[model samples]
Target: MNPTIELLNSHRSIRKYKSQPLPPGALESFIKAGQAASSSNHVQACSVIRVQDPSKRAQLAHLAGDQAYIEQAAEFLVFCADMKRNTEAAASTGIEPTLGMTEQLIVATVDVALFAQNVAIAAESEALGIVYIGGIRNNPSAISELLNLPEQVYPVFGMCIGYPDHQPEVKPRLPLEAVLMQDSYQEHEQAEQVAYYDQQMSEYYQARTGGNKTSNWSQSMAPMFGGKLRPHMRDFLIAQGFTMK
Candidate 1:
């Protein structure tokens, strides 16, 4: 594999970070690199907030399921899917702009994901460790209020970047055959493949955690399917001006 592919394949989430801060301008450089990612119709409907204040970081950590890494990481960022700026820019042309189309929500969310992935890859190439925090959505309204996010803008996720204190083994992924379909969708042996993958994951967890974790992939996914996860999100998004049409 080439250098980029090798880097991408070896990516691992780093939760334990060192006390050292990032080099000066490192965060800015990564964000600039992220901006190079493709945007929908050049809408660029994404914004990132760097959380440097200790108090704010602590609050964010609490909001994000008490993920202490938010406070411990050298740099913490909240990536927001923002349509406010673009809508305002369009409305400045003496015409009313649409506020909350479902497609608009999809575009903004995809834009932010693409932009943040670029930043993640850039930071990894620079030897910085990074972890994405989706728990920010556990209490979206609180997080938005804490960051003072405006309508037509919502926090999609958060990211923590810093030097790694512990090197973790890369987690395994499903086989390509299980995920990559051909010209048309088919699931001939998907169940068998998933079962095998589950076995692999079960062993992986045991090895990675020194026999502390014994759950397989299916078991790990139980909580997500067990109940209505984050039921407040729909109402929260609607209140934030993303009515999903």
Candidate 2:
């Protein structure tokens, strides 16, 4: 495989990080690389907030399920889906641009995700460790207020970047046969595929945790699907001016 493919496959979430700061201008370079990612209609409806203040970081850490890595990482950033800039730019012209469309929300959210992934890849390429913190959505409103975000903007997620203090084994992924389909959406053999994959995952978890974690992929997903996960997200997005009309 090519070097890029190798790097992509070897990606791991780094929880513990060293105290060393990033090389000068590294963060800027990563952000710039993120900007290079494709956007819907080139809207580039995404923004990043670097949380440098210790007090704010501590509060954010608590809000995001007490993930201390948010405060401990050399750099922490909140990636936001921002349509405010586009709205203002459009208002500058003669037409009254529409707002609160579902498509608009989707575009902005997708843009933010793509941009953040690019930032992650760039950071990883530089031998830096990073972890995406989706827990920021746990209290999106509080985080938005803390970041001074305005309407037409919402926090999508946060990312932590720093030198690695520990190396974790790269997690295994679903088999190609289970995920990659033919010309159409085929599922005739899904049960068999999933069963096989589950066994593989069970073995992986067992080895990784020294038999402490015996749960497989299907079993581990119980909590996520058992109930309405993050039910507040709908109302929060609407309040942020993403009315999903």
Give all TM-scores, in the order shown. Answer: 0.98, 0.98
- Model 1 gets an lDDT of 0.95
User: How does each model score on lDDT?
Assistant: 0.95, 0.95
C-alpha lDDT of residue 69 in model 1: 91
Question: What count of clashes does model 2 give?
Answer: 0
**Per-prediction tally of clashes:** 0, 0
**Per-residue lDDT for 148 in model 1?**
95
Identify the runs in model 2 with alpha carbons over 4 angstroms from their true place: none
Lowest summed lDDT window (length 10), candidate 2: 185-194
Residue-level lDDT of model 2, residues 1-245, one tens digit each, is 89999999999999999999999999999999999999999999999999999999999999999999999999999999999999999999877989999999999999999999999999999999999999999999999999999999999999999999999998888888888998987688788888898998899888989999988889988999999999999999989999999
State the lDDT at 104 in candidate 2: 96
Off by over 4 Å in 1: none
- lDDT string, candidate 1, 60-99, tens digits: 9999999999999999999999999999999999999978
